[model samples]
Target: MSILITGANRGIGHALSRAWQSSGTEVIQTARNSPGMEPLDVADPSSIKELAERLEGQPISTLVCNAGVSLDKFDELETGYAPELWAESFAVNVTGVFLVIQALLPNLRASRDAGIAPKIAIIASQMGSQNSPAGNRFIYRASKAAAINLGRNLAVDLESDGIAVGIYHPGWVATDMGGDSADLTLDEAVPGLRKQIDELTLSETGCFKSWDGSDCEF
Candidate 1:
C-alpha cells in the first residue's frame, strides 16, 4: 500500500514513516525542510498544490496529517498575547491539514480501484475535547478542536466515496511538542497507531480514538 505522511522529518510523523518503510510499504514522506523524505510545506497553499502536481499519478492509500505546531507558552490568556501565534498554530494545524487533504483527494480516490482502504488520519489531541475540561493549552486546544471537527465533517462527506477519516491522540508522546516527561515514545506510539489504522472500518470513521484503539470523546 502507498502512504503519504506530512511532517515526516521528525517525531511521530518521522517514526510512522520509518515504521511503514521498514514494513515494505510505499511511503511518501513530506516535510517543510529539504532533508525531508519529500518536500512539502503543509501551511503553504502553493506548496500543497505543487506537491499534488508532483504526485499526480501516484496512488495514496493513506494520508496522515501529522504536521502541527503548539504555542505552549500561551497556555493562559494574557493581555497583549501575540495573536499571531494563535494564527500560526491554526495555519499549520488546521488550514494546512485541510489543504493537503484537498490536494490529495484525487490520489485517494484512485485507491478505491486498487482494493485498498483509503483513509485519512489526523493527529489530534485529547486537550481538544469539548466534552473534557479545558486545560492550560489555549492555542493548542483551539487548533486541535478545529481539526477534530474537520475530520468529523470529512468522514461524513467522504463516506459515499468509501474513504474513511478519523482522528487519533498519540497520548503525550516524547516529541518536542509532547516533552520529555511524556508517557510514550515514538517507537511505542507509531506501531500502535499503524495497527489501529490497519484495523479501521467504515463504522469507525468520524471517531476520535487513542493510540491503543480506544474511542475518545469529542
Candidate 2:
C-alpha cells in the first residue's frame, strides 16, 4: 500500500515515514523546504496543486496531514499571541490540512477504485479538546480545534465516496515541537500511530483517537 505524509522531514512525521518504510510500505514523503523532501508547501495553494498534478494517477492509500506549526508556543498570555500569528497558525494547521485533502481527493478515490481502502489521518491534539481546560496559546488550541472539527466533517462528507477520515493525538513526543520534557519518544509514538492509521475504516470514519487507539475527547 502507498501512503502520503506531509512534513515528513522531521519529528513524528519523520519517524512514521521511517517506520513505514522499514515495514515495506510504499511511502511518499513531502516537505516545504527540507533537504531531499519533495516540495509541498501545504499553506500554498499553488504548491499543493502542483504536487497534486505531479501525482495525478498515483493511488494514495493513506493521506496523513502531519504538516503543522506551533507558533504560539512561545507567545505570552499578557503580551503575545498576535493577530498575525493567529492567521499563520490557522493557515498551516487548519487550512493547509483541508487544502491538501481537497487537492488529492481524486487520488484517494483512485485507491478505493483499486480496492485499497483510502484513509485520511489528521494529526490533531488533545489541546483542541473542549473537555480539557487550558489557558495559554489560544491560537494553537483554536486552530487544532478547527482541525479536528474539519476532520470530523470531512469524514461524514466523504463517507459516501468510501474515504475514511480519522483524527489523532500523536502524543507528546520528544521532538522540537513537543520539547525534551514530553511524555513519549519518536520511537514510542510511531508504531501506535501506524496501527491507528492502518485500522481506519468507513464504519469509524469520524473517530478521534490517540496514537494508542484510545478515544480522544471532542
Candidate 3:
C-alpha cells in the first residue's frame, strides 16, 4: 500500500517511514527540509497546494498528518504568549492536517476500488484532552485539541465514503520534542502506531486513542 507521511525527516515520522519502507510499502515522505521528500511548509497554503499537485495521481491508501510544532520562546502562563508561535503550531498541527486530507481525498476514494480501506491517521496528543488535568503548554495543547476535533469531524464526514479516521496519541516518545525522559523510543512507538492503524475499522473512526490502544478521553 502507498502511504503519505508528513514530518518524515525526524523522530516518529522518520521511524514510521523506515518501518513502512522496510515492509515494502511505498511511502511518500514530506518535511520542510528533508532530502528526497516533498518540501512542505505546512504554514503556507501555496506550499500545500504545490505538494498536492506533485502527488496528484498517486495512490495513497493512508495519509498520516504527523507534522507539528510548539512555542519556542513562551512560558505556559506568561502574558507574553507568542501569537506567532501559536500560529505556527496551528498551521502545522491543525490547518496542515486538514489541507492534506482535503487534497488527498480523491486518492483515498480510489483505494476502495482496489479493495483497500483508505484511512487518515492524525497524530494528536493526550494533552488535548479536555477531560485531563491541564494548566500547561497552552499553544501545543490547543493545537492538538484542534487536531482532535478535526479528526472527529473528518471521521463523521468521510464515513459514507468508507474512509476511516483516527486521532491517536503517540505517547511521550523520545524525540527531540519528547526529551530524554520520554518513555518510548521511536522504534517502539511507530510500530505500535502502525499496528493500531492496521487494526482500525469503520467502527473505530472518530475515536481518540493512545499508542498502547487505550481509549483517551476527549
RMSD of each: 1.3, 0.8, 1.4
Ranking by lDDT: 2, 1, 3
For residues 38-148, write the lDDT of model 3, one tens digit per residue.
899777889889987887776788888898886752484656567888788888889988988898898888776688999899999999888895677888888889999
Could you tell me which 10 consecutive residues in candidate 2 have the lowest summed lDDT? 129-138
Q: Which residue segments of model 3 deviate by more than 4 Å?
A: 72-76
**Winning model by lDDT:** 2
Q: Write the per-residue lDDT of candidate 2 for residues 98-197, one digit (tens) a residue.
A: 9999999999999999999899999999999989968887999999999999999999899999999999999999999999999999888889998999
**Per-residue lDDT of 218 in model 1:** 91
Q: Across residues 1-218, which tens digit of lDDT does each residue of candidate 1 receive?
A: 89999998889988988899988998998999856468898888999999999999788999999999987653455663378988898999999999999999999988977888799999999889999965577788889999999999999999999999989998889999888999998888888998887777788899899999888989
Candidate 1 clashing pairs? none
Q: Model 3's lDDT to the true fold?
A: 0.87
The best candidate in terms of TM-score = 2
TM-scores for every predicted model: 0.95, 0.98, 0.95
Provide the global lDDT of candidate 1 against the true structure.
0.89
List the candidate 2 regions with Cα displacement exceeding 4 Å: none
Q: What's model 3's lDDT at 193?
A: 88
